[model samples]
Target: MAMTMRKMAVVAVMLVLAMAAQEASAAGGCNAGQLSVCAVAITSGSPPSAECCSNLRAQQGCLCQYAKDPNYGRYISSPYARQTVASCGIPVPKC
Candidate 1:
């Protein structure tokens, strides 16, 4: 019984570690809130700002993930957001 419990504990620890690693890698260098710079630009008709451009560039690798996110996917796919990205000279990620 003790051995079984030990094995279960080890499995639980491994599962936690694996989930952590996946979360880290899934972020692809962009953590939560990293794209907040683009919020105004995304939600309005105004042009993209310098900070927006910088953040967008920095988070390029995470664009696909962002597009797949339920909350952000809509904004990322909107025409205004696409225009903002284009005006910033950043191509819209195909994701």
Candidate 2:
């Protein structure tokens, strides 16, 4: 019983580590929450500010991932969002 418990603990630790690694690798290491700086620009069709552009560029690779999310997809996939990305000099992702 003790041996089984030890093995279970090890397995749990391994699973946690794997999840952490996956989360870190997702969205090209970007956390979409960081893109809040661009919210106004994306929603209002205004030119993005320097800080918004910086954050947008930083998360360039995550655009597709954000576009695939139900909660965020609409915003990321909107025409305004595309314009905002282009205004920032980043290519809008096809996704």
Candidate 3:
């Protein structure tokens, strides 16, 4: 009985952790397509639009990976990109 209880407790903890991770990812904003559009706009030197900002806020977690990529990182790391993120009120994530 004690072993069963311990296993259940461990399972409960794992479930909770998994749920939390999902919530965190969901809150980070933007689907892959939206992120791609935002990245393209930034690379083109155009000011991000309201939609772009919305997506940026939504996909904040994914941005770090994009920021680290050779093709995308240049635009992601640009001052303009940082400014856009700041303007949108999304906290710049440390990649």
Give the winner by TM-score. Answer: 2
Estimate TM-scores for all models.
0.66, 0.69, 0.54
Cα lDDT tens digits, model 1, 1-95, are 97686556435434433443366576456543555556556655478789878877877777776667664566667787788789889888887
| 55 Cα displacement, candidate 1 (Å) | 0.5
Q: What order do candidates take by TM-score, descending?
A: 2, 1, 3
TM-score of 2: 0.69
lDDT of 1 at 34: 51
Report the Cα lDDT for residue 48, model 1. Answer: 79
CA lDDT of each prediction against the hidden true structure: 0.65, 0.69, 0.60
Q: List the residue pairs that clash in candidate 2.
A: none
Model 2 lDDT per residue over 7-56, tens place: 56435434433443355476358566666666666656778899989878
Candidate 3 lDDT tens digits, 39-94: 43443445677887887887687777666755445556777668778767888777
Candidate 3 achieves a global lDDT of 0.60
Poorest lDDT segment (10 consecutive residues) of candidate 3: 12-21
